[model samples]
Target: MKNMNIQVKGTIAPGYGVASGKGGDSRFPQGTIEMQKPFFQELGLDLSPYFSGTLNISIHPHRYRVKSFKYTFINVKWSSIQPAEDFSFADCRILFNDSSFEGLIYYPHPDTKPDHFQAADILEVIAPKIDGLKYGDELILECDRTQIDIVIVKKFWKY
Candidate 1:
């Protein structure tokens, strides 16, 4: 078999704070504190992409250890990812079946510990048309892990 061991690089946290706040996280690299709307706009806002799909949140542990979690997209399909007119994009999602993680990215945290995104990271996503989506977008993904057993300890990127 090939190398099943991999390292996680970065992550997209869901609930981030800007100085003072309870919830709201930027899908971009941490320390890049931002508001969702403007952030999405920068990525060419189009909520339609999340109609029925997955948005992957990858983790690169900077080379550490940890488990992961994820949301599954059951009824999603490439064709259903609507608004296929001006710009076509892709959807990505990731999850680790047995782990929880936290750490700093981009800008180091006071704790500055390289955690999360371990060798056991999970990834699943649809291909973007082109340009590799160098920006961000608002997306919602649905997942269900009620009928499967995944004991993974490595990173996997599925394009």
Candidate 2:
């Protein structure tokens, strides 16, 4: 069956910088993705094509939940100092300035992740490095409705 797709308007927002290790976190100096790539590769998912850092997108007044997923890696023991974590991914497309780029919805299951909590309205995306993208820029994000569900939590002037 063909997957249903949902598109929503989002804004590029800044994250805690923990994913790319720019937050000065001593434990993950090389970034979380860099540390986890080999483990994911071992599990048969090659994340080498995507950027090392995540693109934080905010769909304010709208929260999200993963109803299904394209890929899920369970109990990934990427760090020696930290506990194993589960991760899920869903196919996504980011459109900005009339350009579209393929990406993945990077979901680190909160039940396993120890720290760096993200808001319900924020989505962490991984894609090829796009030039000229900056914080506060508006973009359209498309995701598989079956994999990721987005809904308006509050009607705040119809954002």
* Highest TM-score against the true fold, candidate: 2
lDDT of 1 by residue, 1-159 (tens): 112323333343332232112323333322222222233345544333222222233433322222322222222222222211121222222223333222111111213222222123323232222222322432222222221123335568999
Looking at candidate 1, what is the lDDT of residue 147?
Answer: 19
**Model 2 TM-score (2 dp):** 0.93
Worst 10 residues of 1 by lDDT: 101-110
TM-score of every model versus the real structure: 0.19, 0.93
lDDT of all the models against the reference?
0.27, 0.91
lDDT of 1: 0.27
> Model 2 over residues 37-140: C-alpha lDDT tens digits?
89989998899999998999999878888898899999999999999999999989999889989899999999999999999899999999999999999999
